[model samples]
Target: MDTWWLLAIPVIFGLGWIARGFDLKELLSESARLPRSYFNGLNFLLNEQPDRAIEAFIEVVKLDPETIELHFALGNLFRRRGEMERAIRLHRNLLERADLPVEFRDQALFALAQDYLRAGLLDRAESAFKSLADTPHADQAAGFLAEVYQLQSEWQLSIDALQRSGADTPAKSRTIAHLYCELAEAAIEHKDLKAARERLAQARAADAALLRIVQIEISIAAAEQAWARIVELADQTLAEHPEFAPQVVEAYIDAAQHVAFSAPGQRPLDTQLRSWFDASPNDALAAVIIKRLEAAGSMSAALEFARVALQRLPRLSQAHALLRLRAAMQGDGDEDLAHITQMMNGMLRSQKRHECRNCGFRAQRFFWQCPGCKQWDTLPYAASPVGP
Candidate 1:
């Protein structure tokens, strides 16, 4: 029986050795399709040694040229790491392969376009995206085209590209309007009033509710010295779009004063100004009133004007207009005037008048479109954008 047990022990160990040999054979066969460098690359990647991993992976790709997935992974890794030249080369090589599947061909083309764009090869990128026009990537390609055209200041091309893109919605109406307005603004800069007018008309057609058209129209009228027309247009537009009340009011006040001061024995525009202030006691309108009162040497009236403004707006352009007004009323003279002038300058310097409601991008001046997000009408009217 002891001898029988010793024989059984040898048989069990032999069976275990045979099983291990079979397992090792299977592992060797499976790993034979992948080079040893592939395992080294994976180990280096696991250790976060990307430079070494890349070198090892390149060795693997060279050893096994049919490693399609490995190529794609490595190519994308290069692109994300800002190695555009390598990404471009790898994707181009993939595209050159006639045996590549249709799906892979399209993916390679898109990746190639991205590589070109990242490298600032805009013309090449444009050509690549144009080739993708009729494919499933058409809409995405169109969006990139819009961005490219806008960046290049090709307003008409940008507008056409946006029209082709599937991103058009009621929400993007102001963006379309701005595209048209940009053309109008360009025309005006080039002294082409007729073309400017036409473009402005198109801008309004894109979004009838835009305040930009009114501002442009006022500017055009100013160029023609049509102060009366400027006032008329400002009033008409302000009636429908009261959100631009501050700007329209300022324009009207300026135009009215220009016409009033140009002619002799003409009544001052104070009546019109006072009437507007009575209807809408905005801080800007009140400020205008105080200026007129101070111009006429009425300190009491100017103090009263500032007091009334403070009731509606506690801080004028986020400055303590009320406290300053009280101090001026207490002091009351050239000292007060100098102090007030300094305060006004401070307010001007501190104020961020326009802000992108979409992206919270603040600006000292107004933008029809946000510089941060490139969206139109996102900059709302506010003297103090970042603060109450």
Candidate 2:
């Protein structure tokens, strides 16, 4: 037994020696495979010269194809520099390799999708992203796919893609609601009332407080000549989102003209609007209320309403409204009206009609999305607080 143990020790030592030699040989080969350009690439990266670094890395990969990581790094740098065609070519080369592992292949496919997206090749991007639907990049790929569909105005497909996005559930649901609202707007433009109604219902179900859905509903009611329904939606919007009160003012006046709203022996349109103005105290809604009073033949009340609002809000717009009303009362005052109009125009020249509450970007035109930040429902009209 003692002799057998001594013999086994040498045999085990011989096997360990062989394994060590093989490991050292593999390490030396990898070290010898690294070219001078690999060090140059590292130096360039340390110096923050990414373009030159990318070029050097590309050379390193050409000399030693074992460095699969260099290919991805090169492709990403090309995409970042707006060289979409180069990125697409490099990633495609990786995808064509039969020896690539599943993870590396998925990485290559994702890079190719991004390249196609950056190049505005929507169809190709969509196809590539769809191939990654069940991979680790599923949520991220869905996000990009949603953006592509949104750009193409394919609202239903956009909503479907967003449902699979990486954003939290509430945010994803909100964006889906916005997409539904977009579909509703398109339906309204084409005079498809049934489709518009169905889309609005879907939008409300997704996001009940989305003010654009209310706006579109009011617009649909206006088209159907359902004045009372318009008033109902406007009032509900005001009660829930007072910031959106300004957008509903004109709807009130339009509805009042078509119907006298009497709530079971209560005051009609003029009284209800006055109550709303008193509750919210908005300049735009005040203007609408005053107009409604004047239409009801209460000129004195209208002038008093403007005067009282001027004393409280003390805004240039309110003062302008007061002066215009007084000028109207004066039978022969073209001079006064002209002066008031000139001053109003000057004030409006510096005033932005729209503002993004999220980024504080101001513009003269309203947008459903903030042009500066590209965030949905961020822009609100400056004259009125309405949703994007």
lDDT of each: 0.77, 0.82
What tens-digit string does per-residue lDDT give for candidate 2 at 45-160? 99999988998998998898878998998898999999988999999999999999999999899989999989989999999999999999999999999988987889899888
| Model 2 pairs whose backbones collide | none
Question: The CA-based lDDT of model 1 is what?
Answer: 0.77
**lDDT agreement of model 2 with the native:** 0.82
Clashing pairs in 1: none
- State how far residue 354 of model 1 sits from its true place (Å): 2.2
TM-score of each: 0.66, 0.69
Least accurate 10 contiguous residues by lDDT in model 2: 379-388
